[model samples]
Target: MHQVIASPQGDKFIIARPGTRKGMQIPRAMHHELSSAVANGRDVPGWLVNAGREAWGLELSGQPARGNVLVRPVTPLNYSRATWEINKGCNFNCEHCYLAERAFEGLPRDEKDRLLSMLRDAGVLWLQFTGGEPTIDRDFPHSYRQAFILGMLVEILTNGSRLHRPEIIELLSAMPPHKVTVSLYGASPESFDSLTRKPGAFKLLTKGLKAAKEANVPLELALIVTKHNAHEVQAMREIADEYATTYTEYANISPTYDGNPQPLAAQAPGFLDKSSVFKGCPAGHTFFHVDPHGFATMCKVGRENPIGLMTEGLDGLLRLPAIADAQMLRSGGCSGCQLSATCRVCRPLAKAYQEAKAPLNTYCQHDNGDETA
Candidate 1:
């Protein structure tokens, strides 16, 4: 595996490690030189060796550019980021899961290889592998290694259940991810097991966390606060602090991606923080999401007008920007809302809430006398 990935992102050129955030912005001239050297099968440049040493403490001197450093080719597509749901499967049954049904299903190995290539061709420099729990998938190791081989910075969104497995740890240790984000259900075993509906969930999670930390895997914790574990928020923070890992809190729960309202029952009433104002996002334009079977959507939430990568391929993505625009328009219950100017929910998310017949107070700001929110 290449120690570093050198790729072009729009007008910028960056050299970054596969596992860590450490990177350096190189000038156009330097980028061109590196690209030419890789294309021509030349040795690593002296300047890059010195620079890598300075930036990431890497020793690249006397190494061949062909295998030691991966130089990604520029592509016609302008997309920079993407998220692929490896499979909608999980070991734990969290009540607050956004996926209504966790099914263990995805494309075959060859089809997945094709999809990753298409993503690379689409200029996706950063790729996130997510799932109901990505690590549980049998093809995860192959997919992860393939993404890294293609010179894309890979990030894993997992529950950390399988991190303790010897093969999983060994694979991660060999080809480090840009980051491994683990969701913390609860701090204590009782609360954690209860929330997940799995008796030994907490013990397994703790074991995985320790193993991943010992293996020096880059990790970030997502503290998923629900009614069942809201009381343990401080203890959760303490656990994160104990590991000296960065963490973010997720208190507000949403309905399932397919507009199912079951997950909303688990929302901690006191912890439902107001969402940030919905500024315009570059979902389909700069970034997109793909489901397990390779159907690409504008984002994870807006599952409308999916383009099946298995049949349609990269050309199908050309329609995404327009699809995204159509989906973002204020429609249905949100049409002509006076409060849309200040509303926090985007049109697609608002539509999901509408489909679920969620309480207006949960997502809408319109009062009873207003225009039928």
Candidate 2:
């Protein structure tokens, strides 16, 4: 007979020729079974046994559980802006690229298609497509159309390089992504290229922005505070007011920038991370970061590592060994912050953490005689 055996952790099942120990290990969602067991007196083994009966064509003695355990209960927030990296490689040579190692060219077409289905299955109703520059990908337009058909509200983050082309502009204006956020590196070529380290990038972005404005598409601007553009703060703010909604600012906290000499903190851009939303670590209550290579962690930057890609889906990811570690770190990162009440969760910070090693070497340098603003 074909059947499976459960582990004490309730995360894995060994599928064997009934009763054999040597079986293919499979990931199991523990929410309902574990919850039911805890609800019915911690008889986890019994609960799983019953769960197996139903999964493997056996008769359950009582009512069966419905729905996946890993999925959080549905609510209005399900569609609230989920971010996805559409492409990994970047065009610019910034001094502080956190994902410098992982950042490569675009994902394969088939990989993109698979990821779309995966996101949809994960209850992702809205997608914020970020990249080195999403506009650089040739399939981005088609990707946009596909996401739209899946009932997703799509957003894009681009350097605005390819957007100057009429074809790109026309599609964006016609369909209109839910939002388009552009990174305005500098006020002019001299200022922009100084930071991006790529001559002509500033001009390319400006051309793209102007076309976007002419296309009648809503455009927003972002700026990262770096040694190259700190003095442009006021100018950036004024420029933001010119045509964009708000200036979404970030600091110089990429992997390459950590532990390095930088301008004063007062010279850095103002920003917030999610921890500002709660009193302490919000690991369990709040969301966690899913790294580009696929690992789940507590605060994205902390040392805890609970789970990993044990299978083909996220169901397996939630059950990894590092989750608890991440959770503890998540709790600690939030619980002890001196400015917890005033702080906010910053994805870029988490992005840096997930993409680089800790002591993070960048923002966490609270000890340096140089904790600028």
* Best candidate according to lDDT: 1
In candidate 1, which residue ranges exceed 4 Å CA deviation?
A: 365-373
Worst 10 residues of 2 by lDDT: 1-10
* Shift of residue 290 alpha carbon in model 2, Å: 5.8
TM match of model 1 to true structure: 0.95
For residues 160-197, write the lDDT of model 2, one tens digit per residue. Answer: 77778988887776555667888877676777897777
Candidates in order, TM-scores: namely 0.95, 0.60
| CA lDDT, candidate 1, residue 344 | 76
- Clashes in each model (backbone N, CA, C under 3 Å)? 0, 20
Query: CA shift at 302, candidate 2, in angstroms?
Result: 7.1
True lDDT of residue 266, candidate 2: 22
- Which digits, one per residue and each the tens of the lDDT, describe model 1 over residues 1-373? 6888788888888898888888998887888898888889888899999988998899988888888888777777768999999999999998888886789999999899999999999989899999888988889999998998898999889878888999999998888888898889899988898889898998898998899989999889999998889899999999887653599998877898789998888888767666777888888999999999999999999999899988988889999999999999988888877777777778888888889988876666444535465
Off by over 4 Å in 2: 1-81, 256-311, 317-373
Give model 2's TM-score versus the native structure.
Answer: 0.60
